[model samples]
Target: MNRTTRLQQITVTLLSAGLLTLSGWGAAASPVQAAAASVAAPACGTGDHGLLQDLQKAHSGADSIPLSFSDVEFLNTNIGRAAGNGFLIGTSDGGCHFQKIYEGQWSFQQIDFPDNVHGWALAAVKDGQAKYLLRTADGGSTWTRLSNQAVTFERVEFLDSSQGFGYNRASTYYTKDGGESWSLIKTPANTRGAAFTSRSNGWAVVIVPGSGYRVMKTTDGGAAWKQVLKSSTSDPIYGQISANDSQVYALLYGDSGMSQTSYSLYGSSNSGGSWTRVIAQETAGGGPAPGSGAAVAKKGPASGTPGNMVLIGKTTAFLAGYQPAAEEVGVGLTKNNGRTWSNQKAVPGFEGVISFTDHNRGWLAARDLNSSTLYVTKDAGATWTARFSFETAGR
Candidate 1:
């Protein structure tokens, strides 16, 4: 998602979830005040062993300032997950430019067709509201416009350099020869999010009108899809899915005001053919009393809400979120697939979005003083180092 659209979604979600109070057209709480109360001290782990000191000694400090994408509204979705080789892509200035992070170094370059770039996918595919599609083969060094006619896509994903898919409310499009050619695929339902494990294996969360959310699977590329699971309640369930070689994991959240404001984690080893509830934890204001037949007790404040979740391995994952009532931001991890969780030490900032490329390397996007900063961690969720700061970059 583009930074602007993602921020708008966050504002709307926060308002709906009662995390932010709105008086007229303004927020009652300032970003700085909220951030001041939310930051948590780092929880350095056993292997930490002066990793921060080592980083300082090796790089002399984190990457220098004047970083790309530091001027515009920043969102956690701005940074893409790290590829197998540790190639990471991020947007700057709302997708007008690109930021490449490789080998612990950061570099920036402008997109060839910079107008209205709303979303991007791996293997360098860029699309936007203007119906334009562009691709870059040699990283961001050069870009090629791929579409002659107009097309609108809200999300795009590429499993590899040769295959990709893009979609919106109206239609789904796919390409095999990189982004050079495109074709249409019939969608099972209106999809909110989509991810592919391979060229022919993928999953999508479909909004089934008044029914609820349905997890769909596709094995013949995009030619067909089958419903793997349908929510049992009328309450809306928003889901984010991640997949590895043999299993698919879904982190789900119900409606904001439901009596039981709990979140669920489900895993399927057979490509969404069947699912097992891995973890279900009640939120602060909803569900049964702790240890009174509940599987997992609430850990954060009474009004804490769930945020982004990433599965780095079959049995390991991380979740980031905050408790608006207490102005506390927290991160948690589940080593045994979510059956049990341990809250990491607080890190003193509103955790917005988190992305993990592997078991121990990840990045977090946080908001403070109405600006965004990026933090990187090489030791799981232990110690984090500030990699990019908007304020410092601007100076």
Candidate 2:
């Protein structure tokens, strides 16, 4: 059997063995239809700074702050997908700090990492250019600068501490001995995003410059690749690609008009050869509501287009977003792969990113004028409780 097929079999076996549980918020309750009232901010004492506050403080007097706290990446270990075990690379004026959260509490220790380091993949600056790959085996406490390469990497993915892949502006690269060395993987230009199920099976989304996007799959690591799906003029495709062991999901977006922004969710069971449109909706841009004075646009899905998504299984997934029409943040649940969707209760505040540990438990990062907080949901997004609140630091 091929590596992809074997990996799928192993995943099925693990799930059957109860090694993995597929539970998340709203796994049992009905779909929510209305927005949940905004809750009061939790009382936090001194020394309870949030990730954003730290970033703001770090670049307080700088001419420009290129990084936003909302854009900071949080790495969730696969062993405990969302049970409060995660890592965040904190940045501030001083330097970088590795923050680890265990059981809902955060412990931080500063490290000698560079600023603007995003996600688990690290990069080093040489003469104002990011030129080398770096890895940290001991969480984010320390990093070993890998041998320098002639590529300016923009994104990197590590399946484990040692093995991983990275891509520059127009090329793909891989490394097996951590980031110490890397070899180029020939692929089409304009490749933007990639995900690998194993060393030999993976997929990437390549944009055709002024045209649209296409999905590419690799079976022998990144050494070889083939185009599996291409966007046509009739149905233009544009969005990011995310995958698991057996399936790949794409959150596509299209601009119809100021009053007709389109969003769609597509899934592929056989890599990227074909896709099924699981959910489709059109966002009514800022305009008169239906039956008002102007032309009434199509109503958006009950659940707004989520900026992020977390797939629990082949058929189960959760999407959450802050709806401008309703002026609230809400979540939607789909058990049959987007054929049908149920809107969960909306919560007040802008939901930045959503992560789930299982099918029944997850966490959300929310931001408001006064503070940024992390909310935890135990009932699969049916309800939420504020777990941590960080006061926005003053300018």
Best by the lDDT measure = 1
- Model 1 whole-model lDDT (C-alpha atoms): 0.48
Model 1, 83-141: lDDT tens digits are 21112333322222223323232221122111122323222222222444546543333
As a TM-score, model 2 comes out at: 0.59
TM-score of each: 0.57, 0.59
lDDT (CA) per prediction: 0.48, 0.48
**What would the per-residue lDDT of candidate 2 be over residues 1-395, giving only the tens digit for each residue?**
00111010001011222221212111221223111112222332223234445544544564522222232222221111111111343211111112222111121111111112211443334123344454544334444455555346655666544566665445667777766677877665667666666678877777665566677888887777898766532334345566776567765555544424465556666566666666556444522211112211132233454565666666667666665444466666666655566666766564455666456666666565555556667787889776555554353
Residue 140, candidate 1: Cα error in Å is 2.1
